[model samples]
Target chain A: MRALSKKWVALLGVLPALALVAFACGGEGEEGETFKIGVMESLTGPGETYGTVAVQAKQMAVDEINAGGGINGRMLELIIEDSKCNAQDAITAYNKLTDVDDVKIILGTSCSGAMLGAAPLAEEEGVILFSGLATNPDIANAGDYIFRTSLSDALLGVDTGNVLWADGIRNLVTITEATDYAEGVRRTTVEQFQKRGGQVVGEERYPSDTTDFRTQLTKLFNENPDALHVAAQAEFAGGTIIKQARELGYDGPIYGEVVAIGTTALEVAGEAATGTKAIITDLDPANAKGQEVLTNFRNRYDYVTLPWYLGSAYDNVYIAAECLKQTDDDQDADGFRDCLYGITWSGAIGDDYSFDQDGEVVGLANVVVEVLPLAERTQDNQGYRVLGSAPAE
Target chain B: MELPIIGDIIRLSRDPKDSLRLSRSNLEFWVNLLIISWAVAFAIWQGVGFAITVGTVFAIWAILSVSLNLVVGFTGLLSVAHIGFFGIGAYAMAILTSDAAYEQLRTEAIPTLGWPFFAALPVSVGVAGLVAVVVGIAFNRFRDDIYVLVSFGFAVIAFNVFLNWRSLTRGAFGIHEIERPAIGGWVFDGELEFLALVLVSLAVVILIAWFLMTSSFGRVLTAIREDEQATEVFGYQVTHYKLAIWVISAMMAGLAGGLFGSWTTFVDPNSFVLMESILLVSIVILGGLATIWGSLLGAMAFVLLEEGMRFLPFLPSEFVGQGRQVVLGILLVVLMLFRPQGLVGRYKL
Candidate 1:
């Protein structure tokens, strides 16, 4: 019995280590005709909807690349992992992609928390993790391997401030959803709002998934700030917070970042959602360039999973595939990484699309949209109104 | 294999001939204990080793369940608030062990707090116990049902504190990069090593609970549970006895929490929600409530149930991504309605 226990223990010990070794030392059984890129995104939880968009966009990019002779005659294959918008799960997925899948490049991570965790892991493991949705700058600094296509939380803060300024609201109250992503935007918005001569009323925070936001709403309403700044991801919490604020009898302008919930936020908040000032960075699916990509993506994927975020994702895959086309089929991690850094294009969002050393989208613009009469704004079958773009000076 | 006290516990906890012997009883217990210990040893010897992380989770949760069993099972008090207690220990130890990390993570400025490793453990346990003492006094008037509601309410309140107390707890983003514990020029840096510590601590806590369960006080607590009115009629001060056990259980929870915080090196409000407390109770109930061995077995089962499910990733990607808690919820319902006596019922049906 003792010997058996010892044997079991030894086997258990050796098994995990052995598996880890196999995973880390993955070899190409069929190395000939494919460049595999990992797409790690939150398919569910806080960022589920956005993740759907990212997934489709990534697929579109894959289809486009494969059609273009498959990254220099080698077809592009994407391995997808759903992060579930959590750090632990995101990290595990990240390790699996980099180690087991042996993906030379990554298109990834929508949730800020997921991005933050994954960014660090990617940096530690030296895998290039470029994301389209996570906005926090801490994510940018997590490692050299980390990069983002979305606007920085700091810049988003400034853009939101610009919207508030344009809308003629100078006194702002901030209520962040109390995650690193939301909190960073909240702080940045406050800094920019105050810097631009806006009077600050007060600030408060609530945990995510809170059903009763009455306590925080009561506080924000009592402050009577000219505008209320809601910093959150698009989800029930942000929308519900706005709805609760409205129910508390404050009908002021809502200056929101990405945290205004889904379009459902507008549906739930109703009249209160109107006059909401927001800075959006999503693709205008109706634009000639975006429409062409959207049509192609639809025909290719059988359905539009999420039309907006996926455009950029589609671009990312094509971008990586484009880079791979220039590299030797049997290059090392560093060589592949170098090729990834060198690619630039006129694709999905706009022309001269390129990444900086920090892996941030350079020369990007934020499109400011106002919550208007749903009838007037509803056009072209797209869910939102694209008023205009705001590029940072 | 004959020692009086050990023999008594085995006869009481692992009686194979009583027909109460669960499938794989002795073998399961010893194997689990051995595996758990081995996992911990590997983590300590290695570094936050994966298997060790699995083992640490079991040990911490098991010990936590045992501690909570004192309140939920013996005293018949219902408080989903133990997760809050778990949070307290985690937060307390984290604030101590990761003072530098806290300073970096928290936005607001606060005074630096640094304490020795041993000193932090006692402080965390003390704080959690003290809080439990205060909460127990206020909510002791209700029966278990209302008690659960009120306790759940308290857990929400604690969760709010964890989330909004940004200066202290860093709200929701989680305070990260905590330093490992240092003792005599050696740091407990690896998860396997950490797991070993967790197992030893879990064993010690369970042993203490075993001692308490068989003690005169344990009898009184059980008496109060089965018939509080009868105990009251018998001239026992039920409130005081209940409070004593609550405090003891809270200390145990705090100890487990400190170890947990140390191991994760990161703490967040999500870790302390009411559901976690409920999960702890489920483990205790599953392994036969009011028994120390039950708590240990339940904790092991709980961890295994959780980590084991990951082996078969059969769900569609969409369901797989967001379905963990949903599955847990269904399992809990099944366990509750079908196996009410629990896997190791105190008196098997």
Candidate 2:
């Protein structure tokens, strides 16, 4: 009788653990509670500068939404987590938000690798994870629970290669950085560029943190190709390419992907990167609506955040809040996941986001931008004018 | 709490004495593994990519962790270089299975000479084993703490090779798209079936490992661990025993390397970095040292704890990306401070 009583005591003690599971599973939106949206961005790392502005942009959107009486009269709360651009770290941030906070909609994540780990976990747990800057096409159909805002590495590769080929630049020097994302750009660009009949004369891969590109620049100097294609989304690499190309006295046209977002390229490369060609999805330099967004974001965030990809992170929270407002029922991870496909709001980028079959934005066009002379560029309430509207079409 | 649902008839007749160890009418790990294998086969039949990914990871880790136990727990020979051996194994299989973008690498790097996956698997592991033997012979002279530092050096050196060896490893980009086994015109397809195969392979390796640990040589190792000087007095060659165990451990790491390649379908310096070796040590520490059963139990516990923790966000953010490592660090410190014996504690051979 005594032993049986002790066993009962132990079993009763374990009830608390079972209760935890119960607690974790509970907490769907009640009749009165505000719908919570999670903003998971890298608050630290190489992307922290962008993340800082993104947080402001996110706040601007949320505050405006709340001021307008919010969705269905329930105020939307923005819960933010800093993923720090690491996968395991992002998972930790995600769990803290999803498991305990019970936020159904996750607005994340900056890094592709971090998103890869967090996305699967989110899908498994039925948390509808929407990423802002994850550009890998493989991730779009990764799981039914995953969705993202940016175009793929493959798409930009095709776009850039075809554009260069059309410009009659056959001789090219391709330099890539040593990271999965950078290497991915390298692989796709090389393949696409070759397909477009562009001759890659000199090919070399630089270290991710290389400051001096004199050797590679010198190699390129000798080849003197028609165009120099640098495949890296990093600023330091972009800056080095600009500075080194000028130093090595190779006066060829330069083109790169999102590497132009960093102002360091202009600062370091001086007038060299001005004429450098870059691809983007949005331009706020001359467009009225775009200029207004860039100014408000800068004022609210205390920094200018103008990249189209960065705005999407801000817009992720707004879309989720809007979707939750439209739906009457709340016990719906799959429904909410489905609801995300039904967005049509003219937010940050001045475009109504229409999610396609893969939950990617349809007609998401990439614009070719030329870096202008610093003297000619106008500094406004936002920042500097980066690109003109595709040479006035 | 859950009783084994299946019975193991083969284990009983083949080894009547061993049968006494397990409860009658209850399945042991082997039987459980057999059932799991069937389930995995079904999963693979349904889809190859997912199954194979999980299988490759499980099998690699299982072999890697258990083989590590031979040195860390049973032999009391602390090494942080098991990851180095893992890298060697992976590089070997990668170069063998794939057509050589085949460039020259650092010191530990081998050309693999375009061997088939099967041929590369053993040869690579053998290379690891040989390296372990040579290293063991040299390091055997040092007693206690010095041996650990030396092993640590080996792991670091191995990492350097993977990191700086540009032509072969492509530096940080790593070796990608190593082909999987194509049996009967069906490329493994990398599904749950592959994961099951890896799991089955893990279970089988554990069983074989159990047999090895139970053998007479294992008894000598136990004696040496308890007191090397005393074992020498008892007419046993302690150095030879150490070398043999190290060789086996190295080979197992090699096998794990092959399995990891199949799962990720990619191998890089990152996969076999020294941190992985540290994780293997932590697995034994948390589960229990010197206990074969503990190694298996430890792996399951590690996986479960890691996955479970992902569900709890109330835990400190310091416990985030580095949280698992932080928790393991704290747990290890506490374990060493108090229950130095580990969770299951040490066991007899």
Candidate 3:
């Protein structure tokens, strides 16, 4: 009975300790001495591959700014939160960043779903939610405070339509992943293609998690279109579709956007990816300044997947720093937003790219590129040889 | 009569008169009231930020857990389709209230009703409850592992329908700009205000659960749980009781989902996956089976523990997300070793 009582005493001591720990850990962080910017990204879920790279690039830029004597004498501090590439997690991450971290500026949310989810809250709260990679067209109207360095799918679709017509592909067959990004690209591309009097022979949409696309491809190929468009949200899906479509003996020229023709996608698809054309925003390999940025990134990270995303994410940090410098106050969201509207800054992504009235990036163009043959592919070149720019809509 | 850290909240007295009086049950009820009141008060004191956000989420999870506990804990029906009803309710809410446009199959527009919150939420609940009744009728014959497998299939099917039904749910694009609950001009837009609405709704759910559990119908459900054949022998029409409880539990989950849709102002297929159903089951099981108050405690602990992992000083910044998952797994494993019934659980699942 005495021993049991002693055990009970020990057990009874746990609740207050837990409460103490929670309260102790939640003590307010020291503020104002540094420029605190929050980053929300999918560090663990489906978007982790690009999200991790984006976070690294942002961190690299932050380090460089702090090393160059800290954003006007105050060091830059980033409070990072994982969105898990979903809406609810993004909202939670947004709350933590804005409420707990007391940050006025948030960068990221790699996935479009996460961006759309948190964009409403950030817009209503008057916080600057800037993204480097989210490309859904809905984000353009998400709010006044929403801005992205990434090109919207709306423009990509228009470029794709232009590319398809220019290449003399009159009848098109499309297979799209059922995601905001992929569907946005497919639907807008189809709309533009049809506007240009191009005929769509077949259209198919599979779920985001679909692995077997043979059935969808088989159905599409039955229509016997002149060209096929593969709209995929991730590298694996793009690669799988390309590889499987090739296996099914559809030899017509294949078309895709950035994700489907990305480095990882090319690697996954292997020789099957050859001759496939993609309209994507890419760093000009000939640009000395862009080359230097890529070199620095390679030296620091020792790897590169999506070089353009890295460059864009890097530019976002610099962009944020520029806005902060213009405002001279971390809390002045209106001043920062106005600064964004007025300023035209050049960085790793592109030169003289500024935000439009709707906060969409202006001045960057998507380039048409073709995947090189297996024998010609190199690690440095990442399996693609750049063609000239896509024709303007 | 005292019970360790839980104190007198869960004392298992052998006294026949004492058990009948259920004074300890009242103690548990009072403790739950105290905890919820403290949480609300603290969130208000802390102002509208992380605390209020977490508090709001806690109430929603508490509602889901308490309702799930009715089916899983009280009636011995292991449901993996609770989140499906949640999705239906959320979609119903979003589809009914929002004026968001979905371009239907490339040519025309799918219509949005744009009803107010008061009208939309009840319809959402009714829709979910109706679905539950249909599913419950179909699933009434199965038990144990078979029931679990079949219910899991239901969850998968529901998720697919949400994902592929582009005209209605807009596929993976999601329904956005869901309005906050409003009565005329008083919109529950502020975080604090929304949290209060959620807390009040949770209180109503708890009361309903309490009333149901304390009634003679609840005793019959418990009897059915203990021995279905014997309960049938005692002339208790076991299938009817099970179906009734299932519908009630599903309706409560639907209500939670409606609030979830409004609070986040967004609903997507990703939020209602099969894994979420398993998570709900874990929450109910971890909090202790057959105890309504245990669901409240379970949700509080789960939410706080997840949020608290963000504040772990030792974890490297890069590994924070992955590290949180790992640490949570380890802690849950340790907890299970110590108390297989769960933190305050009475049954071992």
Candidate 4:
């Protein structure tokens, strides 16, 4: 009995010490000479495809900045962590980044859930958590330190409404993935479309992991609206929805959000995806800098497909670099946050783009893209044709 | 070198049977108290705010694991839907106390009472217990494996309701700006204060669990777990005992969930998924079933292992997050192989 008690006591004594040692492992990065910026992406989950692209874009930007004399002569190092696109994982990743790695500026969080989970912690820790692709409207007011270069779903929803209205689609039915990203877009689009004198005939939502949309699509098809809006995170789901909707024999104009514009949609839906339109942040093919980025990304990755947030992620790294360059004290989180708030620059995405007080990117122009046949699509495009820029709100 | 009285106390604590006499069984009790107190003091002294926050979260998980142990460990019922009760308490507290609830009320043009955090606790507990009664009545018909399946289904259904019920639960967007617990104008806003609240709650929960474990009612539960048919032949209504214990366990889980929602100041459907329920079961199994203190140790070990993986220098930064789960999987396998009953558990699987 005494031996048993001693064994238990010994185990208890060792466990807490192990915890303390874990907390004490990571040494602080050298002051001012090497700026450590953390990156939290969903590297190995449902958001893996987009996360991989976003990380590549961020790395491309970081390499460019280093190649051009670095950020104020201090080499920028990115400490990347996976969020797994979940709130709990995001919090853990955030804690490690702030406490262990000691990074003040964080570029991350492709998913809305990840951003929301880390926002309060970032606010408390006084770290600047800037997202490359999180677009949930709730994030606009999440924290003073939380900012995003990507356009909010609110803006994209309004753009979708305006573009559909301009195209003379009067009645619409919406199908959304039951995630924060897709739901936010669906809600805002329905509201904005209704306010613009367009009628929403019906709306349906399904969980993110769901593969079968036959029931929902069949039901939406019964409404026989002028258009069907697909609000989904993954292109596979979006494409499946389109293919299944077409199989149901309702061929009215199909609209998609920013999430539906990638090559996955085309690959899954095949020829049925042609003529599908989406509201996407226009990447100007004519611009020299945009072409340069496109060329570099293609050469490095050997992948023709570009996810929606690739441009935003590329531009976010430059934004963080520019913010660090402008700060009087680069080491101060508050100073870096303030400098980020005040600065504006044109990059691969567009011109004169800056963050508003709520940390939303200002003057982000949206354009409508029509999925065209392989032969009709430009060499620069995967399967999309830029169908004129939408009027800026 | 030990004194006679101290030696006796230690011997009494190491005994497998539960005891109520403080003079005989105070060793385990005092050791647990000292370990918790020392951990709290060490976290604060380290002055690492993240460590404090993680410690508070650990306390919350400990509370949950202990409550779950009441049903799964003591009663031998594989109730995986404990997270359902947790979600119920969280959503109930969030809806009853949050400013969002007030706004929602105004939007619906309904009258609002706006319950405070403390006032909301009983409501949350009652709601969880009430739901447990309904589920328990329906589920008590099923035996062993079927019960596990039915209970797991409950967790999935509850998660869906929390996700799709936008009018009440706000669906996937989650309720934000939840008010932290306050006492006579002193809000528990800081990490230390929140940690203190969590620790106090854990202590109370441990006391309740200990009391129950050492009582006649607890012995009946153990009997039911060992052999329901034999226990029933002894003139006990097996269903009633099961239902009663289920309700108590659920109410305890609800209390823990209420604390969690307020501590994080946010509650989303994702926080209470089937994975979370599995995690609670793992905590009990790892700490050793039928042992109250084992649950606490299991929670500590689990949280420490998960968080400690972040500090492994051998793992590259990119692989560290996912690699943590890999290492944890290996550790659990090794533990099961070496110590199947659990590290401190007296019961055999």
User: Using lDDT as the measure, which candidate wins?
Assistant: 3
Residue-pair clashes per prediction, in order, are 18, 17, 1, 0
lDDT of 3 by residue, B281-316 (tens): 988987888888788887876776676566565565
Runs in model 4 lying further than 4 Å from the true structure:
A1-25, A28-32, A44-49, A67-69, A84-88, A100-102, A294-306, A374-380, A391-393, B1-47, B100-114, B346-349
Candidate 4, residues B216-275: lDDT per residue as tens digits? Answer: 999999999899999999999999999998998899888888887777666777788888
- Candidate 2 lDDT, B221-269, residue by residue in tens: 8777788999999888888888888888888888777766644445555
Q: Is 1 or 3 the stronger prediction by lDDT?
A: 3
Can you tell me which runs of candidate 1 are displaced by over 4 Å?
A1-47, A51-108, A115-130, A204-225, A240-252, A270-272, A284-308, A312-361, A379-383, A391-393, B1-49, B99-119, B184-186, B323-337, B347-349
lDDT over C-alpha atoms for residue A170 of model 1: 80
Ranking according to lDDT, highest score first = 3, 4, 1, 2
Per-residue lDDT tens digits for candidate 1, residues A213-310, read: 88877887787678888887545777787788878888777777544724567666666676676776656654577678877766765655334456
Q: List runs of model 3 lying over 4 Å from the truth.
A: A1-30, B1-48, B101-109
Q: In angstroms, give how far residue B22 of model 2 lies from its true place.
A: 30
What would the TM-scores of all predictions be? 0.79, 0.63, 0.91, 0.87
Which DockQ values do the candidates obtain, in the order shown?
0.14, 0.10, 0.38, 0.29
TM-score of chain B of each: 0.83, 0.76, 0.87, 0.85
**Candidate 3: residue A92 lDDT (0-100):** 89
DockQ of 4: 0.29
Candidate 3 accuracy as TM-score? 0.91
lDDT of 3 by residue, A1-393 (tens): 345333433442343355456556555565677898999988877788878888888898999999999888999988889888888889989998888778889999898888988999999999999999998787887889999999999889999999999999899999998777888899889989999999999999887678889998999999989999999988888999999999999899999998888877888899999999999999888766667778888898788888899889989999999889878788888888898888797888778889999899999999999999989997678789899999865
